[model samples]
Target: MSESSDGAKDPSAGTLYPGESPRVYRALFNIFPPYLFGGVRVRHIADDWTSVRVTYTVRPWNRNNPNRAAFGGTLYSMTDPFFGIMAYGQLGRDYRVWNTVGNIEFIAPGRGTVTAIMELSREQVDAIRDATRDGGKSITDHAAEIRDMQGNLVARASQKLYARRLRR
Candidate 1:
Protein backbone atom coordinates (compact mmCIF):
# COMPACT_ATOMS: atom_id res chain seq x y z
CA MET A 1 0.00 0.00 0.00
CA SER A 2 1.01 3.58 -0.51
CA GLU A 3 2.28 4.53 2.92
CA SER A 4 3.15 7.94 1.56
CA SER A 5 1.85 10.55 3.97
CA ASP A 6 0.82 14.02 2.78
CA GLY A 7 3.66 15.75 0.91
CA ALA A 8 6.06 13.13 2.12
CA LYS A 9 8.66 11.16 0.21
CA ASP A 10 7.82 7.76 -1.15
CA PRO A 11 9.98 5.15 0.52
CA SER A 12 10.20 1.40 -0.36
CA ALA A 13 9.91 2.46 -4.01
CA GLY A 14 6.74 0.40 -4.59
CA THR A 15 8.84 -2.71 -4.72
CA LEU A 16 7.57 -5.85 -3.04
CA TYR A 17 10.36 -7.35 -0.98
CA PRO A 18 11.88 -10.50 -2.42
CA GLY A 19 10.00 -13.59 -1.26
CA GLU A 20 7.03 -11.32 -0.58
CA SER A 21 3.83 -11.10 -2.58
CA PRO A 22 4.16 -8.30 -5.11
CA ARG A 23 0.72 -6.83 -4.53
CA VAL A 24 -0.08 -3.75 -2.51
CA TYR A 25 -2.45 -5.04 0.16
CA ARG A 26 -3.06 -1.79 1.97
CA ALA A 27 -4.28 -0.18 -1.23
CA LEU A 28 -6.52 -3.18 -1.70
CA PHE A 29 -7.65 -2.73 1.90
CA ASN A 30 -8.70 0.85 1.20
CA ILE A 31 -10.58 -0.22 -1.89
CA PHE A 32 -12.86 -2.55 0.05
CA PRO A 33 -12.53 -0.51 3.25
CA PRO A 34 -13.73 -2.50 6.22
CA TYR A 35 -14.98 -0.65 9.32
CA LEU A 36 -11.46 -1.41 10.61
CA PHE A 37 -12.82 -2.53 14.01
CA GLY A 38 -9.50 -1.30 15.35
CA GLY A 39 -6.18 0.15 14.30
CA VAL A 40 -5.17 -2.74 12.08
CA ARG A 41 -2.06 -2.62 9.94
CA VAL A 42 -0.40 -4.90 7.43
CA ARG A 43 2.88 -5.62 9.20
CA HIS A 44 4.55 -8.10 6.87
CA ILE A 45 3.74 -10.06 3.74
CA ALA A 46 5.97 -12.78 2.41
CA ASP A 47 6.13 -16.25 0.87
CA ASP A 48 2.96 -15.52 -1.10
CA TRP A 49 1.09 -14.50 2.05
CA THR A 50 0.39 -11.62 4.41
CA SER A 51 -0.09 -11.05 8.13
CA VAL A 52 -2.05 -8.22 9.67
CA ARG A 53 -2.03 -7.11 13.29
CA VAL A 54 -4.93 -5.42 15.06
CA THR A 55 -4.53 -2.91 17.85
CA TYR A 56 -7.14 -2.86 20.58
CA THR A 57 -9.09 0.19 21.61
CA VAL A 58 -12.19 0.66 23.70
CA ARG A 59 -15.04 1.54 21.43
CA PRO A 60 -18.60 1.44 22.77
CA TRP A 61 -20.30 0.70 19.46
CA ASN A 62 -18.32 -2.51 18.96
CA ARG A 63 -19.97 -4.22 21.92
CA ASN A 64 -22.46 -6.71 20.57
CA ASN A 65 -23.46 -8.61 23.74
CA PRO A 66 -22.91 -5.93 26.40
CA ASN A 67 -19.74 -7.77 27.33
CA ARG A 68 -17.82 -4.90 25.71
CA ALA A 69 -15.34 -7.15 23.92
CA ALA A 70 -14.21 -7.25 20.34
CA PHE A 71 -16.99 -8.78 18.30
CA GLY A 72 -16.67 -12.22 16.72
CA GLY A 73 -17.52 -10.82 13.31
CA THR A 74 -14.58 -8.47 13.59
CA LEU A 75 -12.21 -11.37 14.04
CA TYR A 76 -13.71 -13.23 11.12
CA SER A 77 -13.47 -10.23 8.84
CA MET A 78 -9.75 -9.98 9.51
CA THR A 79 -9.30 -13.46 8.12
CA ASP A 80 -11.58 -13.24 5.07
CA PRO A 81 -9.26 -11.33 2.77
CA PHE A 82 -6.19 -13.47 3.35
CA PHE A 83 -7.48 -16.52 1.50
CA GLY A 84 -8.02 -14.57 -1.68
CA ILE A 85 -4.79 -12.63 -1.43
CA MET A 86 -2.68 -15.67 -0.63
CA ALA A 87 -4.18 -17.72 -3.44
CA TYR A 88 -3.62 -15.00 -5.99
CA GLY A 89 -0.05 -14.56 -4.88
CA GLN A 90 0.64 -18.21 -5.46
CA LEU A 91 -1.28 -18.38 -8.73
CA GLY A 92 1.08 -15.59 -9.73
CA ARG A 93 0.08 -13.62 -12.84
CA ASP A 94 -1.68 -16.50 -14.56
CA TYR A 95 -4.88 -17.35 -12.77
CA ARG A 96 -8.07 -16.04 -11.18
CA VAL A 97 -8.79 -16.87 -7.56
CA TRP A 98 -11.97 -16.46 -5.54
CA ASN A 99 -13.38 -17.65 -2.28
CA THR A 100 -16.12 -20.21 -2.81
CA VAL A 101 -16.85 -21.05 0.81
CA GLY A 102 -15.74 -20.28 4.34
CA ASN A 103 -16.47 -21.14 7.98
CA ILE A 104 -15.12 -19.59 11.16
CA GLU A 105 -15.07 -20.69 14.79
CA PHE A 106 -14.70 -18.20 17.59
CA ILE A 107 -12.67 -19.66 20.40
CA ALA A 108 -12.29 -16.77 22.80
CA PRO A 109 -13.11 -13.13 23.46
CA GLY A 110 -10.58 -10.90 21.72
CA ARG A 111 -9.62 -7.97 23.91
CA GLY A 112 -6.16 -7.13 22.64
CA THR A 113 -4.03 -7.02 19.52
CA VAL A 114 -4.58 -10.04 17.32
CA THR A 115 -2.48 -11.23 14.41
CA ALA A 116 -3.90 -13.14 11.47
CA ILE A 117 -1.35 -15.35 9.72
CA MET A 118 -2.14 -16.96 6.34
CA GLU A 119 -0.23 -19.12 3.88
CA LEU A 120 -0.72 -21.71 1.13
CA SER A 121 1.56 -24.69 0.87
CA ARG A 122 3.20 -26.01 -2.28
CA GLU A 123 1.05 -29.12 -1.93
CA GLN A 124 -2.14 -27.08 -2.02
CA VAL A 125 -1.11 -25.36 -5.25
CA ASP A 126 -0.29 -28.70 -6.89
CA ALA A 127 -3.65 -30.04 -5.74
CA ILE A 128 -5.41 -27.11 -7.35
CA ARG A 129 -4.03 -28.07 -10.72
CA ASP A 130 -4.80 -31.75 -10.21
CA ALA A 131 -8.41 -31.03 -9.36
CA THR A 132 -8.84 -28.67 -12.31
CA ARG A 133 -6.95 -30.82 -14.79
CA ASP A 134 -10.21 -31.37 -16.70
CA GLY A 135 -10.50 -27.61 -17.22
CA GLY A 136 -13.24 -27.20 -14.63
CA LYS A 137 -12.95 -25.00 -11.60
CA SER A 138 -11.22 -26.47 -8.57
CA ILE A 139 -11.72 -25.99 -4.87
CA THR A 140 -8.79 -26.03 -2.45
CA ASP A 141 -9.15 -25.76 1.28
CA HIS A 142 -7.12 -23.24 3.29
CA ALA A 143 -7.09 -22.21 6.91
CA ALA A 144 -6.07 -19.22 9.03
CA GLU A 145 -5.89 -18.43 12.71
CA ILE A 146 -6.13 -15.24 14.73
CA ARG A 147 -3.82 -15.12 17.73
CA ASP A 148 -3.84 -12.66 20.60
CA MET A 149 -0.79 -10.66 21.57
CA GLN A 150 0.13 -13.37 24.01
CA GLY A 151 0.02 -15.95 21.19
CA ASN A 152 -3.26 -17.38 22.40
CA LEU A 153 -5.65 -18.69 19.80
CA VAL A 154 -8.67 -16.44 19.48
CA ALA A 155 -10.32 -17.66 16.28
CA ARG A 156 -9.86 -20.12 13.45
CA ALA A 157 -11.30 -20.08 9.94
CA SER A 158 -11.23 -22.40 6.96
CA GLN A 159 -12.12 -21.59 3.39
CA LYS A 160 -12.36 -23.16 -0.01
CA LEU A 161 -10.76 -21.16 -2.79
CA TYR A 162 -11.99 -21.51 -6.33
CA ALA A 163 -9.25 -21.18 -8.89
CA ARG A 164 -9.16 -21.18 -12.67
CA ARG A 165 -6.44 -20.49 -15.20
CA LEU A 166 -6.99 -17.27 -17.08
CA ARG A 167 -7.53 -17.55 -20.81
CA ARG A 168 -4.68 -16.07 -22.74
Candidate 2:
Protein backbone atom coordinates (compact mmCIF):
# COMPACT_ATOMS: atom_id res chain seq x y z
CA MET A 1 0.00 0.00 0.00
CA SER A 2 1.11 3.54 -0.69
CA GLU A 3 1.17 6.21 1.97
CA SER A 4 0.42 9.89 1.56
CA SER A 5 2.74 12.66 2.63
CA ASP A 6 1.18 12.61 6.08
CA GLY A 7 1.83 8.82 6.40
CA ALA A 8 -1.78 7.66 6.09
CA LYS A 9 -2.33 4.99 3.49
CA ASP A 10 -3.50 6.47 0.23
CA PRO A 11 -6.81 4.90 -0.65
CA SER A 12 -6.53 6.00 -4.27
CA ALA A 13 -3.42 3.90 -4.79
CA GLY A 14 -5.36 0.81 -5.96
CA THR A 15 -4.17 -1.37 -3.12
CA LEU A 16 -5.66 -2.51 0.14
CA TYR A 17 -4.34 -1.07 3.38
CA PRO A 18 -4.99 -4.40 5.08
CA GLY A 19 -7.53 -3.78 7.87
CA GLU A 20 -7.31 -0.05 7.56
CA SER A 21 -9.19 0.86 4.38
CA PRO A 22 -12.55 -0.50 5.40
CA ARG A 23 -12.33 0.88 8.90
CA VAL A 24 -11.30 4.28 7.62
CA TYR A 25 -14.12 4.39 5.10
CA ARG A 26 -16.65 3.10 7.57
CA ALA A 27 -15.70 5.85 10.00
CA LEU A 28 -15.92 8.47 7.28
CA PHE A 29 -19.36 7.29 6.20
CA ASN A 30 -20.69 7.07 9.73
CA ILE A 31 -19.66 10.63 10.46
CA PHE A 32 -20.94 12.08 7.22
CA PRO A 33 -23.79 14.41 8.18
CA PRO A 34 -26.38 12.97 5.84
CA TYR A 35 -25.80 9.42 7.02
CA LEU A 36 -25.30 10.35 10.67
CA PHE A 37 -28.51 12.34 10.85
CA GLY A 38 -30.38 9.77 8.81
CA GLY A 39 -29.33 6.93 11.11
CA VAL A 40 -27.46 5.07 8.38
CA ARG A 41 -24.30 3.29 9.41
CA VAL A 42 -21.81 1.37 7.30
CA ARG A 43 -21.06 -1.84 9.11
CA HIS A 44 -18.55 -3.45 6.79
CA ILE A 45 -16.68 -3.20 3.52
CA ALA A 46 -14.78 -6.21 2.28
CA ASP A 47 -11.08 -5.64 1.85
CA ASP A 48 -11.28 -6.66 -1.79
CA TRP A 49 -14.10 -4.24 -2.39
CA THR A 50 -16.39 -7.09 -3.32
CA SER A 51 -19.11 -6.41 -0.74
CA VAL A 52 -20.51 -3.93 1.72
CA ARG A 53 -23.01 -4.14 4.58
CA VAL A 54 -24.92 -1.17 5.90
CA THR A 55 -27.55 -0.68 8.54
CA TYR A 56 -30.34 1.85 8.85
CA THR A 57 -31.86 2.43 12.22
CA VAL A 58 -35.32 3.88 12.55
CA ARG A 59 -35.10 6.90 14.80
CA PRO A 60 -37.58 9.62 15.62
CA TRP A 61 -35.65 12.08 13.51
CA ASN A 62 -35.74 9.79 10.49
CA ARG A 63 -39.15 8.18 10.84
CA ASN A 64 -42.15 8.75 8.67
CA ASN A 65 -45.13 10.43 10.29
CA PRO A 66 -47.66 7.88 9.16
CA ASN A 67 -46.44 4.87 11.12
CA ARG A 68 -43.13 5.90 12.71
CA ALA A 69 -41.43 3.68 10.16
CA ALA A 70 -38.13 4.34 8.53
CA PHE A 71 -38.48 7.06 5.96
CA GLY A 72 -38.35 5.97 2.32
CA GLY A 73 -35.49 8.33 1.57
CA THR A 74 -33.42 6.97 4.43
CA LEU A 75 -33.98 3.43 3.21
CA TYR A 76 -32.92 4.43 -0.26
CA SER A 77 -29.89 6.28 0.96
CA MET A 78 -28.72 3.16 2.73
CA THR A 79 -28.52 1.38 -0.61
CA ASP A 80 -26.61 4.11 -2.37
CA PRO A 81 -22.80 4.48 -2.80
CA PHE A 82 -21.71 0.91 -2.13
CA PHE A 83 -22.02 -0.42 -5.66
CA GLY A 84 -20.24 2.53 -7.21
CA ILE A 85 -17.45 2.34 -4.68
CA MET A 86 -17.02 -1.38 -5.19
CA ALA A 87 -16.91 -1.06 -8.94
CA TYR A 88 -14.53 1.83 -8.86
CA GLY A 89 -12.13 0.14 -6.50
CA GLN A 90 -12.28 -3.21 -8.25
CA LEU A 91 -11.82 -1.68 -11.66
CA GLY A 92 -8.83 0.35 -10.48
CA ARG A 93 -7.36 3.64 -11.71
CA ASP A 94 -7.47 2.61 -15.34
CA TYR A 95 -11.22 2.96 -15.54
CA ARG A 96 -13.80 5.60 -14.77
CA VAL A 97 -17.01 4.57 -13.04
CA TRP A 98 -20.09 6.39 -11.93
CA ASN A 99 -23.54 5.65 -10.63
CA THR A 100 -25.72 7.09 -13.31
CA VAL A 101 -29.12 6.34 -11.84
CA GLY A 102 -30.74 4.71 -8.83
CA ASN A 103 -34.15 3.48 -7.78
CA ILE A 104 -35.82 1.96 -4.75
CA GLU A 105 -39.01 0.00 -4.15
CA PHE A 106 -40.47 -0.27 -0.68
CA ILE A 107 -41.76 -3.71 0.18
CA ALA A 108 -42.54 -3.21 3.85
CA PRO A 109 -42.30 -0.59 6.53
CA GLY A 110 -39.01 -0.69 8.40
CA ARG A 111 -39.74 -0.11 12.05
CA GLY A 112 -36.34 -1.04 13.44
CA THR A 113 -32.83 -1.59 12.16
CA VAL A 114 -32.65 -2.63 8.52
CA THR A 115 -29.61 -3.89 6.67
CA ALA A 116 -28.54 -3.79 3.04
CA ILE A 117 -25.83 -6.07 1.72
CA MET A 118 -24.28 -5.11 -1.59
CA GLU A 119 -22.07 -7.48 -3.52
CA LEU A 120 -20.10 -7.50 -6.75
CA SER A 121 -18.86 -10.76 -8.11
CA ARG A 122 -15.50 -11.33 -9.79
CA GLU A 123 -17.39 -12.41 -12.88
CA GLN A 124 -19.18 -9.07 -12.93
CA VAL A 125 -15.86 -7.27 -12.63
CA ASP A 126 -14.41 -9.31 -15.50
CA ALA A 127 -17.42 -8.56 -17.65
CA ILE A 128 -17.13 -4.83 -17.06
CA ARG A 129 -13.43 -4.91 -17.87
CA ASP A 130 -14.06 -6.83 -21.07
CA ALA A 131 -16.75 -4.43 -22.18
CA THR A 132 -14.59 -1.38 -21.56
CA ARG A 133 -11.27 -2.76 -22.72
CA ASP A 134 -11.22 -1.05 -26.07
CA GLY A 135 -11.98 2.34 -24.67
CA GLY A 136 -15.64 1.42 -24.89
CA LYS A 137 -18.27 2.34 -22.36
CA SER A 138 -20.51 -0.06 -20.51
CA ILE A 139 -23.64 0.51 -18.52
CA THR A 140 -24.62 -2.13 -16.01
CA ASP A 141 -27.27 -2.56 -13.39
CA HIS A 142 -26.70 -3.76 -9.82
CA ALA A 143 -29.25 -4.62 -7.16
CA ALA A 144 -29.51 -4.90 -3.40
CA GLU A 145 -32.15 -5.68 -0.81
CA ILE A 146 -32.76 -4.07 2.55
CA ARG A 147 -33.98 -6.50 5.15
CA ASP A 148 -35.16 -6.01 8.71
CA MET A 149 -33.51 -7.71 11.68
CA GLN A 150 -36.05 -10.53 11.37
CA GLY A 151 -34.77 -11.12 7.81
CA ASN A 152 -37.92 -9.78 6.15
CA LEU A 153 -37.41 -7.76 3.04
CA VAL A 154 -38.17 -4.10 3.58
CA ALA A 155 -36.99 -2.60 0.29
CA ARG A 156 -35.23 -3.30 -2.98
CA ALA A 157 -32.86 -0.99 -4.76
CA SER A 158 -31.10 -0.88 -8.10
CA GLN A 159 -28.26 1.26 -9.35
CA LYS A 160 -27.28 1.84 -12.96
CA LEU A 161 -23.57 2.42 -13.39
CA TYR A 162 -21.43 3.55 -16.28
CA ALA A 163 -17.82 2.54 -16.81
CA ARG A 164 -15.19 3.24 -19.41
CA ARG A 165 -11.49 2.75 -19.70
CA LEU A 166 -9.40 5.83 -19.19
CA ARG A 167 -7.13 6.32 -22.16
CA ARG A 168 -3.54 6.07 -21.05
Candidate 3:
Protein backbone atom coordinates (compact mmCIF):
# COMPACT_ATOMS: atom_id res chain seq x y z
CA MET A 1 0.00 0.00 0.00
CA SER A 2 1.21 3.50 -0.86
CA GLU A 3 1.17 6.34 1.67
CA SER A 4 1.14 10.07 1.31
CA SER A 5 3.42 12.48 3.15
CA ASP A 6 0.63 13.12 5.66
CA GLY A 7 0.30 9.35 6.17
CA ALA A 8 -2.83 8.97 4.11
CA LYS A 9 -2.93 5.65 2.31
CA ASP A 10 -3.02 5.43 -1.45
CA PRO A 11 -6.34 5.86 -3.23
CA SER A 12 -6.59 2.12 -3.66
CA ALA A 13 -6.34 1.67 0.08
CA GLY A 14 -9.27 3.88 0.95
CA THR A 15 -12.99 3.39 0.63
CA LEU A 16 -15.41 5.98 -0.71
CA TYR A 17 -18.12 4.82 1.67
CA PRO A 18 -17.05 4.12 5.22
CA GLY A 19 -18.46 0.64 5.63
CA GLU A 20 -19.55 -0.40 2.17
CA SER A 21 -17.47 -2.85 0.14
CA PRO A 22 -16.17 -1.80 -3.26
CA ARG A 23 -18.16 -4.57 -4.88
CA VAL A 24 -21.37 -3.17 -3.45
CA TYR A 25 -20.49 0.30 -4.63
CA ARG A 26 -19.74 -1.02 -8.09
CA ALA A 27 -23.10 -2.80 -8.19
CA LEU A 28 -24.97 0.35 -7.19
CA PHE A 29 -23.04 2.41 -9.73
CA ASN A 30 -23.86 -0.06 -12.47
CA ILE A 31 -27.55 0.50 -11.90
CA PHE A 32 -27.34 4.27 -11.79
CA PRO A 33 -30.03 5.68 -14.07
CA PRO A 34 -27.75 7.54 -16.42
CA TYR A 35 -25.36 4.65 -16.81
CA LEU A 36 -28.10 2.08 -17.14
CA PHE A 37 -29.85 4.08 -19.84
CA GLY A 38 -26.62 4.75 -21.67
CA GLY A 39 -25.51 1.11 -21.60
CA VAL A 40 -22.54 1.93 -19.39
CA ARG A 41 -21.62 -0.42 -16.59
CA VAL A 42 -19.14 -0.19 -13.78
CA ARG A 43 -17.30 -3.44 -14.13
CA HIS A 44 -14.84 -3.01 -11.29
CA ILE A 45 -13.66 -0.59 -8.66
CA ALA A 46 -10.38 -1.23 -6.85
CA ASP A 47 -10.53 -2.12 -3.19
CA ASP A 48 -8.97 1.17 -2.14
CA TRP A 49 -10.79 3.37 -4.69
CA THR A 50 -7.60 4.00 -6.65
CA SER A 51 -8.85 2.55 -9.91
CA VAL A 52 -12.04 1.84 -11.83
CA ARG A 53 -12.93 0.01 -15.02
CA VAL A 54 -16.08 0.76 -16.92
CA THR A 55 -17.60 -0.70 -20.06
CA TYR A 56 -19.90 0.89 -22.61
CA THR A 57 -21.73 -1.20 -25.12
CA VAL A 58 -23.27 -0.07 -28.38
CA ARG A 59 -26.68 -1.56 -28.10
CA PRO A 60 -29.47 -0.81 -30.53
CA TRP A 61 -30.89 1.84 -28.28
CA ASN A 62 -27.52 3.45 -27.60
CA ARG A 63 -25.94 3.28 -31.04
CA ASN A 64 -25.62 6.34 -33.22
CA ASN A 65 -28.15 6.71 -36.03
CA PRO A 66 -25.98 7.01 -39.11
CA ASN A 67 -22.91 5.03 -38.19
CA ARG A 68 -24.58 2.70 -35.73
CA ALA A 69 -21.59 3.10 -33.44
CA ALA A 70 -21.46 4.02 -29.79
CA PHE A 71 -22.80 7.48 -29.09
CA GLY A 72 -20.16 10.12 -28.43
CA GLY A 73 -21.92 11.39 -25.35
CA THR A 74 -22.00 7.92 -23.83
CA LEU A 75 -18.31 7.41 -24.52
CA TYR A 76 -17.53 10.69 -22.82
CA SER A 77 -19.82 9.83 -19.94
CA MET A 78 -17.98 6.60 -19.32
CA THR A 79 -14.80 8.59 -18.70
CA ASP A 80 -16.36 11.08 -16.35
CA PRO A 81 -16.62 11.03 -12.53
CA PHE A 82 -14.08 8.29 -11.75
CA PHE A 83 -11.06 10.53 -11.31
CA GLY A 84 -12.79 12.91 -8.93
CA ILE A 85 -14.10 10.02 -6.91
CA MET A 86 -10.63 8.54 -6.63
CA ALA A 87 -9.05 11.82 -5.62
CA TYR A 88 -11.72 12.43 -3.00
CA GLY A 89 -11.34 8.99 -1.54
CA GLN A 90 -7.58 9.27 -1.34
CA LEU A 91 -7.70 12.77 0.12
CA GLY A 92 -10.21 11.63 2.75
CA ARG A 93 -13.20 13.57 4.06
CA ASP A 94 -11.50 16.88 4.77
CA TYR A 95 -11.05 17.81 1.14
CA ARG A 96 -13.55 18.59 -1.63
CA VAL A 97 -13.00 17.22 -5.11
CA TRP A 98 -14.85 17.84 -8.33
CA ASN A 99 -14.31 17.27 -12.03
CA THR A 100 -13.95 20.73 -13.50
CA VAL A 101 -13.59 19.82 -17.14
CA GLY A 102 -13.92 16.82 -19.41
CA ASN A 103 -13.08 16.27 -23.06
CA ILE A 104 -13.09 13.32 -25.43
CA GLU A 105 -11.65 12.75 -28.87
CA PHE A 106 -13.07 9.88 -30.80
CA ILE A 107 -10.48 7.75 -32.56
CA ALA A 108 -12.78 5.18 -34.00
CA PRO A 109 -16.42 4.13 -34.13
CA GLY A 110 -17.10 1.81 -31.23
CA ARG A 111 -19.29 -0.88 -32.68
CA GLY A 112 -19.08 -3.25 -29.74
CA THR A 113 -18.05 -3.05 -26.10
CA VAL A 114 -15.42 -0.51 -25.20
CA THR A 115 -13.66 -0.37 -21.85
CA ALA A 116 -12.23 2.61 -20.06
CA ILE A 117 -9.75 2.03 -17.26
CA MET A 118 -9.07 4.97 -14.99
CA GLU A 119 -6.44 5.02 -12.31
CA LEU A 120 -4.98 7.46 -9.79
CA SER A 121 -1.45 6.71 -8.72
CA ARG A 122 -0.23 7.31 -5.20
CA GLU A 123 2.01 10.05 -6.48
CA GLN A 124 -0.95 11.84 -8.01
CA VAL A 125 -2.97 11.68 -4.80
CA ASP A 126 -0.04 13.01 -2.83
CA ALA A 127 0.55 15.80 -5.30
CA ILE A 128 -3.05 16.89 -5.06
CA ARG A 129 -2.93 16.77 -1.28
CA ASP A 130 0.29 18.72 -1.14
CA ALA A 131 -0.92 21.33 -3.57
CA THR A 132 -4.03 21.94 -1.47
CA ARG A 133 -2.40 21.60 1.93
CA ASP A 134 -2.60 25.36 2.58
CA GLY A 135 -6.27 25.31 1.68
CA GLY A 136 -5.66 26.72 -1.76
CA LYS A 137 -7.28 25.08 -4.75
CA SER A 138 -5.49 22.75 -7.15
CA ILE A 139 -6.51 21.26 -10.44
CA THR A 140 -5.11 17.95 -11.67
CA ASP A 141 -5.52 16.60 -15.13
CA HIS A 142 -6.04 12.91 -15.89
CA ALA A 143 -6.36 10.92 -19.07
CA ALA A 144 -7.95 7.66 -20.10
CA GLU A 145 -8.27 5.65 -23.27
CA ILE A 146 -11.43 3.89 -24.26
CA ARG A 147 -10.49 0.68 -26.00
CA ASP A 148 -12.44 -1.98 -27.81
CA MET A 149 -12.37 -5.63 -26.77
CA GLN A 150 -9.61 -6.31 -29.25
CA GLY A 151 -7.48 -3.59 -27.60
CA ASN A 152 -7.92 -0.98 -30.26
CA LEU A 153 -8.18 2.58 -29.00
CA VAL A 154 -11.62 3.99 -29.58
CA ALA A 155 -11.38 7.32 -27.84
CA ARG A 156 -9.04 9.40 -25.69
CA ALA A 157 -10.62 11.23 -22.79
CA SER A 158 -9.23 13.82 -20.45
CA GLN A 159 -10.57 15.19 -17.20
CA LYS A 160 -9.51 18.06 -15.00
CA LEU A 161 -10.31 17.77 -11.31
CA TYR A 162 -10.28 20.57 -8.81
CA ALA A 163 -9.53 19.92 -5.16
CA ARG A 164 -9.51 22.11 -2.10
CA ARG A 165 -9.38 21.55 1.60
CA LEU A 166 -12.66 22.31 3.29
CA ARG A 167 -12.57 25.08 5.86
CA ARG A 168 -13.58 23.87 9.23
- Give candidate 3's TM-score: 0.89
- Which one is best on TM-score? 3
- Indicate whether candidate 1 or candidate 2 has the larger lDDT: 2
| Local distance difference test values of all predictions, in order | 0.62, 0.84, 0.85
Give per-residue CA lDDT, model 3, range 1-168, as digits (tens).
457567876553355456666688788888899998889999888877789999998888889979999999999989788898777767776778898888999999997899999999878987886898787899988999999999999999999999997797
- When summed lDDT is taken over every stretch of 10 residues in candidate 1, the lowest stretch is 1-10
Per-residue lDDT of model 2, residues 14-118, tens digit only: 443354466687888999999998889999988877899999889887899779899888898987888878887777666788899999999999988999999
Error of 1 at 10 (Å): 32
Task: Flag clash pairs in model 2.
Answer: none
Per-candidate TM-scores read 0.71, 0.86, 0.89
Candidate 1 local lDDT, 1-168, one digit each (tens): 222225454333223345443346654563454545344555555634433433333356565557766677776777676666766665554567788898889898776567787766655765665565456788877888888778898788888888886565
Question: In model 2, which regions exceed 4 Å deviation?
Answer: 1-20
Please report, as a residue range, the 10-residue window in candidate 3 with the lowest summed lDDT: 9-18
